[model samples]
Target: MKIRASRISDSILIAVSGEEPDPAHQNISRSRRLLKLIAAFFSLFKLLLTRYRRPEFGSLRRDVWCLDEREYFESFQQKDPDDSARGQGGASQQEQRSQRGKGKGKQTARLEPIGDLGYSGSTFFTTPNGKYLIKSLPRRFEYKFFTRDLLDPYVNHMRAHPHSLLVRITDVVHAPHPTLGGLLGVAPTHHIIMENLLYGRDAEGGRFSNKWETYDLKPNDYFFPERDIADGRLAPKSVKDKLVDEFHDHVRVSAANKRELLRLLEADTQLLADHNAIDYSLFLVRYPGPRASTDDGADDAVPDNVPFVDSDASPWRTGLVDADGKWTYRVVVLDFFWARHTFRAWALTSLVKSFNKVAHKGPMSITANPADYRQRFLKMIQDIVVEV
Candidate 1:
């Protein structure tokens, strides 16, 4: 596939196509000319992008940052976690500091994968401090369009309500070379840097250890239950354990808080539905309330760090706790870039490899029409936000 992007006034124009893959064809003829133009184009893009935070949506700014192909290390940052974690009886001294002390200079810290590996067939990794998430974009996704559609509404929501539940997207990245190189059945990769819903509050030095129970939730008949889960097989055990945890079946909050949560959810989903998007799940995380004890779920042992979560991630702070000791939920709809396609579009595009299941049912299923998708999406969200 051939991919290229250029800034168009306030928005960027991204064009990706699976025209021809043969290196022989690409190296010689018009493809070579296109490469030369691209090199010149992006070089110009870097220089011009300095003032181009145009129509900036909070941190949802535009840039073309590259991942170094050379020296760099992943250091899951941990500062003075030694004595506290030891006293708390969390992970072993060795295990907690495993990824640290092995880096140098700018390699001091990097994003690390937590929870489930290869969740939903996409590589899910979070920043060392758990403030940002880096995930693989779908082959069907048009990043420029996706960014524009979601970012506009997201910025507006943040501006109006301040701490909204919408998952804030700060930046979208286009890594030219394959980050997950030679992975079978995987298409060209474009990563999205999203504000992690777990800890929107950016803490000092980015060292966080808040024990949170997380779930990617959807209503019944949503097809969210994978065959692996159905066949009594669930993955990345860390996440699966919490997925089956009884305490998290439903979030407990006051009626007033429930109403507020539902209202925010509806607004976020409406934005997606209006854009003809579906197959998104509301990611729910439960933090410890004042009266609630924080535990990392290791029986007979106290949990790790109580993260003073990142405060810079403004939108996610809307998960307000009530006067009662019941848990509050930090919820955001995720994976809305999976678009429904027209008959002609589907039939024509079917030739390429598909990451998504074409036929689906219920709320999790996608629709070809925007209006149809909107109704189904709203209905499911309304069903989810009940008991208010």
Candidate 2:
């Protein structure tokens, strides 16, 4: 007998023995079974290769891309028993083990709920070390309508560019609900751990009271004063003029800071635009205060009675804190949920409006080098839009 082999398809081969069996007498059913067996074996081989391709990245294996045993079996239900039996049992078992391992990984890092932080059904918690902010799905709901994976890529982007205007996403973990007070029927939650800014207290502490007297504020300046008229010592209009004039000088210094800030914003905007992830709703929180000097040491606290101003004379400082109440003047960027390609215009426009409301006063003009400030901001936005 002579044996000859020939390629049938990319994944199939046929081997024939002897010169050729009589076509009329050929065992057609047997040949068909043999062909089916070859195809099934090839399929199983491909499945194994895909399953073990990135075993270290367990999430990839358990994700929807990989098939479960039941799904695989159901897909090939019409296959012959002998062909399906060849490696089905062993392959199925291995797949189950791979998925089991992934599930175990998720359960071990379960996130504990710390109650509502703000947005509906969005809860906050601290990691085991209590150093990071963990945002997770509500414990009371099963179906999450929001995109959890959207945050993963944003976190990765921030980690690569830590000093960018964007907030930093520290880590991501898979977690399960606490047994008690847990939301019913909710699946294992994916918790995003971020650098928590809430731990730090503003140097001025709380919103500035609008009723406080602004001896230096003009009739048109934006100044928050205490509402209660306990003391009739409102300064005379002449004194207010002197204060407003001096305040305008401080505004000059503030314009310089704003110029620097615009530069930072421009750079960040370009980077985000390049990535094609721009969302106009994205707003950077401005921490208005004098930049802290390292020489000032760590124990510096804002004096309670200092007059509010945009310059270093003002006590408001932005800082970060650990769970133990320790704070530092480190700037952290956060909240990338609204990042998208079209968001730059809205974000920049919002910032401009805010500056106008809080910092800009009288005649809609920049006091300290009007031409320079307007030119810088316009250039910044132009650069951002072009890059995007």
Candidate 3:
């Protein structure tokens, strides 16, 4: 899934590509506009008259709150709402069909559920285009902390530092469904939309043609109930499978890349540490292949939105290659919602300490302090990312 660079002239033409005016169609369009105006007037009148009532759980509006509208819109190179509306309204049936035919390779983004992936009980989903991931915030405190406390800081941080390794969260969709809330104590209605790190890996004959390996890594030099506690050890393989870390080897990169990687990680984790957040993981995806040439005739690049072709250091979407050219690595910091101040975190801290003491082991990663966790996280990455 090579992304072709879009041209300015092509964009300009497409922006103003509405059909020429016809006398017969003019009347229909005028009537439609008049009808729409009438409808809007009535809707406003109805709103003014209707009593202010709290929205019901199931019937509540599914609000799509875009965290960074401009960033994502430009990054995706999506059509403007007005342009889409115009295209739909002005196009003839034949023209509409023709437009659809032209959109052969592109896919309409849709939510597809990806059943249980990790220790975190949150539900997961991916967009049909494989560009975006939707992860549910099953815990109330987690979602509340994100929206109430950390949201502003996170947005500000991302805007201030574009090269931060933190996963890009573009939107938060709050769909209050009675069924989910009523069934589970923790309402899984709030979902976070993020960029998928392993994007384009599954695409046919693209830059990511090589088989990609992924690892959700964290500090393992601590007491883990799955490996330490008796009950956890006795648990089924399925349960233990979720808690395992598959990657154990070091990832070697150029000294410059390593320094940049650590610098970004340090800055990103500092924000999380300040906010008393913990239990974050570095989601790493790597493939054994040479970096794709920019002049590969495809010109598969989104101008200014994606990584710079000239610089070989930080490739945001394309990823960076190791010094040996044995691997192309993409990394994003993930799952930074678990704050120390949260009730669950506090309780778990106590439980973890008691268990650790009994087992005579070190501090558990999930139960460690924000600052301590940040240190461990950085060290974990430093230990693994060998400077070549």
Greater lDDT among 1 and 3 belongs to 3
List ranges where model 2 is wrong by over 4 Å: 1-114, 127-130, 137-160, 175-188, 202-260, 274-333, 338-388
- List residue ranges in candidate 3 displaced over 4 A: 1-109, 176-187, 205-210, 244-246, 291-313
Clashing pairs in 3: none
Which runs in model 1 stand beyond 4 Å of their true positions? Answer: 1-106, 115-120, 138-145, 148-161, 176-188, 200-211, 222-248, 293-319, 342-364, 368-388
For model 2, residues 1-388, the per-residue Cα lDDT tens digits are 0110001110010100011235786656987967754554443111101111122222321331232424222221122234321212222323433443566411112223465542334556542222235564333221121133344443344344434444433333332213211223222233444443432222244343221212111122223121112221565444333222222211122334445445555555454444333222222122223333243333453322332111111111233221222212233223333322223434644655676576552222112222332344335333322210
Residue 31, candidate 1: alpha-carbon lDDT: 77
Residue lDDT tens for model 3, 1-388: 0111111112111222222345776566777877755553432101101111112211111222222322232222333344321112223334533563478522222245565567656767664344567676667788888888888787677656666778776556553323322234333445676777766565443444345688888887766777767767577788776664667777777888788888888899999999999888888887654443343323442122222112112463357767765567788888888889988888988887786676767677777889988898898888888987
Report the CA-based lDDT of candidate 1 relative to the real structure: 0.44
TM-score against truth, every candidate: 0.54, 0.31, 0.65
lDDT value, residue 314 of candidate 3? 47
Q: Ranking under lDDT, best-scoring first?
A: 3, 1, 2
Model 3: weakest 10-residue lDDT segment is 44-53
Q: Could you tally the backbone clashes for each prediction?
A: 6, 19, 0
* Reference-based lDDT, residue 207, model 2: 46
TM-score of 2: 0.31
